[model samples]
Target: MSSQETEVLVVGAGQAGVAMSQHLTERGIPHLVLERDRIAERWRTGRWDSLVANGPAWHDRFPGLEFDDVEPNAFAPKERVADYFEAYAKKYNAPIRTGVEVTSVRRKDGESGFRVETSDGTVNARYVVAATGPFQKPVIPAVVPDTQGLAQIHSSAYHNPQQLPDGAVLVVGAGSSGVQIAEELQRSGRQVFLSVGPHDRPPRQYRGKDFCWWLGVLGKWEMAAPPKGAEHVTIAVSGANGGHTVDFRALAAAGITLVGRTNSFNNGTMHFASDLGRNIAAGDANYLSVLDEADLYIARNGLDFPEEPEARVLGDNPACVTKPLLELDLGAAGVTSIVWATGFAVDYSWLQVDDAIDAEGRPRHQRGVSTEPGIYFLGLPWQSRRGSSFIWGVWHDAGYVADQITIQRGYAAHVADVPLRQAATSAQSHTELSERIAVTQGA
Candidate 1:
C-alpha cells in the first residue's frame, strides 16, 4: 500500500468537509481531504429529487463564496447545492481525493498524530478532522416490522412521488423529511398517512421575516445548549418556497391522514401510540417557546414589529389537532409503501483511538475538540451551538478546526494566516492578500 503524509487529514467531502479544507488551505495548512465519493455525495445521492434546501441559497453558502448571480432567497435544490461545492472545491483547488473511503482512524505508532486507512492506501497526518455532517445513516425504528410485501424506503432514498409504488403511502416520523415527502405525495394525488411524533413546529415566517432571522436576532444560533434540566428539542421547521412550515398541522390541512407514532407491527396490524393531539400540541408549544425567546429578545432590544394574526400562527389553514389513530390496518388502509423519515444515526465506528468515544460510542469531544489530541469532529448536531449541524453553521466550526490544525502543525503562528513577506524593500508596505496567501502557502 502507498503511504503518504500531510499536516491535516479531513474525512468526508460534504459541506463541512469542503469548508474545512478551504479554511485549512487558506491558512497554509498542508492537508488532504479524503472523500468516500464525489463532492457532496450525500446531497447528490441521499435526497429527494424535489428536495430543496431547508434554507435559502444565500444562507447555505460557505464563508468566502456567495451564490454568484443566483437569487439569494431562491430555494436551492440538491443538485444546485452539490454543484456549489464542486465549484467551490475547484475554485480553491482543494486537495481532495474522491472515491477514497476511509476505513479506519487510529493513532500513529509512537507518534502524536493519526494514521488513516483508506480503500486506496494509508495517510499519516498531524491532525484529523471528521467533517462528515449529520445524516450519516438513516435510522428506521426496530418497531417497523419487516413489511411482507409493501415497498419501504428511507427518506434518504426517496426521490419523488413517481418513484413509489402506485398506492397510498405511510410516512413514519413527522419531522421535516416526513412532512415534506408526505406533502409531495399528497400533491401528486397520492394519499399520505403521516405518523405524528414529538417535534418543533416553528412557523416558517414570523413578524414578516424568516423564522431564522428571528433566531439570528435572538442569538439563538450561538446557543450550544438549552438551560440545565430543560430538554434539548430539535427544530423541525421546513423552508420550502422561501419559508413554509411543514408540520403535522400543515400536513393534516393538506388532507394527509395524521396517525399516531408506530409502536409495533404484528399480524398485519401496526399498533400506534395514542399521542397525535399531544404531539401536535407539543410541537406548537415548542414553537411557542422559540417565539418566547424571540419575544424576549425583541423586548430587550426595544424593537417594535407588527404581530401576525392568531390563525396565521401555524398556517393559513392549520389542521385541527386530532385524536390519535391507535391502530391502522396496513392492508385495509391500502398502504402500499412505507417511507421511514425517522432521521439519521450518528456513528464513529471507524475511529480506533481509545477514549475517542464515550460509552455510547459517540465522539467524546467538546466543541469539536476530542479527548485525544489532534483528533477533532465537525458537522455534529449542536457540536458547538444549535446551528452546528446546519449549512449556515458548519463553516464556523470548520474554521475553528482549521486554526487548531494549523497551530498543532507548528506553523509560523497559531494559524498559517501569517502574511508571507517576499523580502520586499522597507519602502513597500501593506502586502496584498493574494501575494500574502501565495507566499504563505509556498512557505
Candidate 2:
C-alpha cells in the first residue's frame, strides 16, 4: 500500500474533526482528516425530517462560522446544520480524504508516532486526534428480543414515520429522540405507544430566560477542574429546550396517551416498570429543582436581566395516574412501525489503544489528553468545560490542544505540560496542605 506522512491525522471529519482541522490550518500545521463517508453524513442521513437542534442556533456554530439567521434562538433544522458543515469544510479547505475507511490505528513502540491503515493507504503521523464522535454506534438493548413478525427499526434507520407498517407502534426509550419519533408517528395517523425512562425535563424558558441561560449561570458551562467527589460525573447537562420535551399536558391536550418504561420483551409483548409514572414525575421535579436553584443563584449574583418573567405552565404531575407499559398488541392495535429512540454508543475497536478508556467506554482523559502520549481526544462531553463537546465548546479545547501540540513539537521553546496523572496527585497534595494550614490558623 502507498504510504503518507503528516503532522497529525484526524480520524473523523464531523464537527470536532473539522474544528480541529481549522485550528491546525490556521496554525500552518500539516494534517490529514480521514472520513469513512462524506462530511456530516450522520446529520444528513441519521436524523428525522422534523428534527431541530435541541439547543438554539447560537449553540450550534463551529469555530469560525456563526449560525446567525433572522430568527434568534431558533432551533436549526438538521439539513441546515449539515449545509453549514459543508460550507465550513470548504471555507477552511480542510484536507479531507472522504470515503476512506480507517481499518486500524497501531501506535509504534519506541517512537512518538502512529500508523493509521486505511482502505486507500497507510500513513504514519506524529499525533492522532480521535475526532470520531461518541455517537459512532447505535445502541440497541440486548433485552429487546428477536421479533420474527414485527417490523422493528432503530431511530438511526428511521428517516420518516411513513416508512413504518400499518398499525399501532411501540416506541422504546423516552429521550428526546424517542419522544419526537413517537409524536411524529402519532401525527402520521398511526397509533403510537412510548416506553418511558429516566429523562431530564426543564421549561423552555424560565422568568424570561432561556434554559441555556440558567445552565450558563450555574457553572454548568464553566470549565473548572472536575469536582473532588464527582470525578466520574460529567457536568454538561443536555439543554432541555433543543430536543423534544413530552409536554404531558400538551400530549393530553392533543389526546396522546402515556405509557411506562420497558423492562423486557417476550412473546411479542414488552414488559414495563411498575412505577414508571412515579419515576417520570420524580425526574421532571428533580430537573426543575436543579434549574430553580440555578436561577436563584444567578439572581443572587446580580446577573444582567433580560426582561420580565414569561408566563408558562409546567406539565401535569405524572404521579396522579400511572400507566403500565402500553404493549401494542400489533394485531389488535394494527401497529405498523416500532422506532427505537435509544441513544448511541462509542465504538473504538478499530483503534489499537490499550488502557486508555474507562469502564464506561469513555476515554480516560483529564482534558483531552489520553493515557497514551500523543493520542488525544477532543469533543467529548465535559472534555474541557461543560460546553467542550458542543459546537462552540470545541474551539476553546482545540486552541488549548493545538497549543499543547505546538509546545510538544519543540517549534516553540515552551516546556511540555505534565500528564494528568501527575497533575491530579499535585492537586490532591495542594488541597491537603491547604486544609492543614486552615486547621493551624483556626487553632
Give each model a TM-score: 0.87, 0.81
> Per-residue alpha-carbon lDDT of model 1 for 1-443, expressed as tens digits?
38998868899889888889888777666679998889998888899888778777767788678877568866787788899999999989999999898999999787567888999999987788888876887888776556478888899999999899888999988777788888889999998888877777776766666666767777877887865644444457676656676556556777888887788898778888887777777777767877777667767888787765562355432443444577888889898999998888777888888887888768888889898888899988888888786787888888777655544443333233544342222232234333444454565
In model 2, pairs of residues that clash are 54-242, 54-243, 55-242, 165-336, 167-334, 167-335, 167-336, 168-334, 168-335
lDDT, model 1, position 99: 87
lDDT tens digits, residue span 1-443, model 2 = 38998879988988888888888777666789999998977888888777776677766687457775615577788878787887898999999988998899888877668988999999999888888877778877776545547777888888786687677887877666777777777777777777666655655555556566666766677856454544432121233335433465455445455667667766655666666676566556756675567567767988675533332346455432353544544466565556777767787777787756777777877777788777888777778776776677777787767656654554222225634333222223434434533543454
Itemize residue pairs with steric clashes in candidate 1.
none
Q: Pick out the ten consecutive residues of candidate 1 with the lowest summed lDDT.
A: 422-431
What is every candidate's alpha-carbon RMSD to the true fold? Answer: 5.6, 8.1
Model 1: residues with Cα > 4 Å off, grouped in runs: 226-232, 292-307, 310-320, 410-443
